[model samples]
Target chain A: MTAMQEGAHVPSVEESDEPKMRDVFSDVPTDTGLATDPAGVVIAELGDADPRILTLSADVGVTLAEFRSRHPERYIEMGIAETNSISVAAGLAASGFVPYVFSMSAFGVLKTAEQLRTGAAYNRLPVRLVGRLTGLAMGFFGTSHHAVEDVAVARAITGLSVVAPADAQSVISLMRATVDREGPVYIRIAEDAQPVYAEPPTYRPGELLRVREGADVTLVGHGMGVGLALRAAARLAEEGVQAEVLDAAWLKPFDAEGVVASARSTGAILTIEDHDVVGGLASMVAEAVGRAGVAAALGSIALPDERLEVGVPAQLYERYGLTVPNVAAQAKALLGR
Target chain B: MRVDTAPPATTPAPSDGDDGGPTLDRGRSITPVELARRADWIRLQTIELIDRAGLGHYSSTFSSAEVFATLYYRTLRLRPSDPAWPDRDRFLLGKGHAATGLWPVLADLGFFPTEWLDTFGTAGTALNDHPDMLRAPGIDFSSGSLGQNLSVGTGIALAGRLQERDYRTFVLTGDGELQEGQVWEAVMAASHYRLGNLVAVVDANGFSGSGPTSDAMGIEPLAARFESFGWAVREIDGHDPEALLSAFDTLPDPSAEQPVCVIARTRKGKGVRMMEEAPQAWHLGHLGPDLRRQVVEEISGRMP
Candidate 1:
């Protein structure tokens, strides 16, 4: 870490000149055919819309550098300070520019939460915050890096739309919707490779995508847990216990109607999330069920309210009962089947 | 109509006409006696609103009455009709305890209805103990947590330079609130960025929550510290309208080397005679009916 000297002129470091680090996933082609995929789909869509997207990130200059190379004058490298980055993005929005500020979820959303609340949500400024390595994605980075409280914090704030994309295609669609949306939005992205669930024009905020429809039990999940929920549904189907799967992409202004309808259709409900059970997806869905006056028994598969010891991401998920089998078992127990 | 550029005179005389008031020859002009009287009426309104709602930081608010009077009444190029105007100057109240002072100033400046002051601190009222930019009109940013405003102000200043706007940004912080680590982080960034367009004023009222700042944290030799951090430091009597105006006036040219800091030493409970030199607890203590009447009389006599 470079120390900034007091009373000295600190020149802005040129991020483009730095050597690039290899992207985590190599098998995933740069060009994915889905409309919301990373390479061509979202970029092409944005390119056709008068090209109003501006990408900015802290410390992750390589990603911004790539975007800048593709879309010159539309990218800014804000360096290591996340608070300044968010505030500048708010200012940029005030000037009629659409800025997507990228940083680690912990620093990007939680560290500079006050700025996002005052500058963007309160002022109704249009800035999309894209936080990478959300939840347990930074598995090896220990507790300090994991952003388990982002969902809760973002939900507490008003006028901020919070979305967690399950895969690359969903990410593209959510990003597209967030850019066109007139208010502040936070998009949490996983660091690892996500399984593609949909093709084109499938995801939208406040709309729950029913990945699998059934009546025995409703399994609702978001972010990386969406894939786990689908797997659990498949396993339950083999056992002749039909389970409905709902992808709750948007966490705030949640799909209350969809959740209520599913709970009424199915006699039981289970919520799976890679966050704390206290204030995350589980609590949100439970609130909706209670408000809808649904009599269905509900269970939540989530991390216990304790600091997770350092370990691999997959092991942590399994240890915290966030895996497919864990969710399926919880749903079975709720259904008493 | 062309706005008057002259500062208010130091004759300590009251005026009768609405627009005909004292004019000063130097500094970012002060509010004339007529305007000061109008401001006093607004201040009285604010006091009534807080007292009725049973919430306010009356002592800190009273200390900066003259500063608020000058800024909202004379200085600042603001459009009350359009609070979100992109080119307007930014005013960030770091020590948000002075929110009571701001409500009346904003009302007088026509940012919101003057009658809204009565709803201050009431349930569902836009006016609260601290300034919320979302709820209140003309508040650039919501600030209550100490030491965060300077960083936010620095961000705004950087944005102004990047966008090439001539608008200036001013942040007011408390002397005791400067203990947070984030304050130093912002101070370093602002001076390193050479934010001459940013001017920070420290309301050095000696006392914190417990007692005098020296007794609490000892932030003595404050001006030299700012100077060492690459800021042009100025010390002034915060209670004197002339001194405050002088400090605000003669701001360093944007082409200069660093940001500016004005350490304005003031009394915590400035106006009310009984509480003028009282302890920090009086910062928010209620002024009883008898004390209120006495305060009114003191303010009326001191108006000229």
Candidate 2:
């Protein structure tokens, strides 16, 4: 197989070694307020609000229904128009109301980019943009719905922070943080209900959570890839290879200090994300490391530049080398095991 | 303090100054002739900037010069030094081609250094052919693509209403620009939301890129169209500064009923004699050396 070159280091798949087992999940607190892990906690927390949060959705209106049943006056169904919804949310924000504008990732960020740039960023309005079905999460919907480019676009706009939460727990925490943060924010949520990975000490914006700390290799991931990285780190640990797992929940205002500390602690770092390798977390981490003068060898496991072919989420993920097995194999190769 | 309301004035003749120049403000009671002269000076400065830059939508810029002058100098409650001052009336130039007019107005209002006008069309200059809010100091929204300004204006107007601020938003759209579907969407949305704080001005200059608007896309009976869209419509001669001022002064109260639309009928190139009735080609085409000298002579003769 042709070896992929990632900044001076080439890790051949054939010359890879297995990693050791370390069950970090046991250390993770089960009491985290997550929809999947502890639905009761999330439901209870949401129930005790002064003024219920308003949730707006684009055409699909799936989340709109759920938010409306709980907070009817708060839910706004803006039909198929995403641009108008963003503007309306800006207006709502001006009225001292917190509004969560939900839409498909592609249309949500790209279509209403000008509104976000002017109404939210320039005006310094506090509005949370929830882009559902992000990063190839809409596997069957093809390229139109896939929001792989949202992170880069959101990051480019000044005063707008971008976050991608790994699982349900991280989503709830990030959503809470977004409301508290006094500016515009873009949050990418996957369509599929992925397994919860973030522990009790909930994910915070601009903070990198280390799931499992190791000395040999580091597995850096954000959003959906965090779950995959944790699973791969566990598999690597079982085979005697020590691999560190880091969840990069915050994409913009990236935690360079955390990344550099982790990279210098370990000699090698592997960044993984569900987005395209070009402008997403991989490029961001590399740029951060380069600017910080960190000399760790970095490799990225992300979607290739080519247009993705249509297939089932699992099939396409495996084909694109984003699975736990693939990440572990790449990590082992990086260590020259 | 009961105020006595007077009847509207008749259509007065285009002014000839008592000192033997084009009358600046003839028969206008509210805005004085001195203010009109300042507006004219601003307009002249605008023409000079466009001519010096060797590029701009000069024809369109000239068409809206009087309106811009009237708004900045006489009407709009704005602080040029602090463009982002809360509770200030918002003015969105929908036809961004009129950046030539806007740049001069903003300079006159001391939004930025007046010397910046000389750098127009040069590389790395903030004064581009289009108005970019990031680049220019006083620009509220970056607008070059036609129909987007009204929507943005609607957002600003909605912001004012939602915040319970008395500030009003005024958006100027070229007659030709009404061809875009988004403008109608904004109109519908503004009316639907009962945004009385919004005033949409249609510069019915009867010209677009190709030729006359009727020959191009036909946006006539424009006042009625706005009225049908649930707006309180007013029609006036756009070139008349006093008439423009009157239309703006009597803005419909948002609490009363609907939004307002001021349909100002104007010539494509109003001030310069040669280009006043010029074809659409003259919109961006520069005046020759001889024509430029002639325009300068004509403008100088019209001054007091």
Predicted model with the maximum DockQ: 1
Clashes of each: 3, 13
True contacts kept of each: 0.22, 0.12
TM-score of 2: 0.75
Per-prediction TM-score, chain A only? 0.86, 0.85
Query: Pairs clashing in candidate 1?
Result: B7-B24, B12-B304, B28-B249
Residue A206 lDDT, candidate 2, scale 0-100:
83
Model 2: chain B TM-score vs. truth?
0.86
TM-score of each predicted structure versus truth:
0.81, 0.75
lDDT of 1: 0.72
Candidate 2 residue lDDT tens string, B40-64:
5655665666666776576787778
Error of 1 at A201 (Å): 4.0
DockQ, each predicted model: 0.20, 0.15
Task: Give the 10-residue window scoring lowest on summed lDDT in candidate 2 chain A.
Answer: A18-27
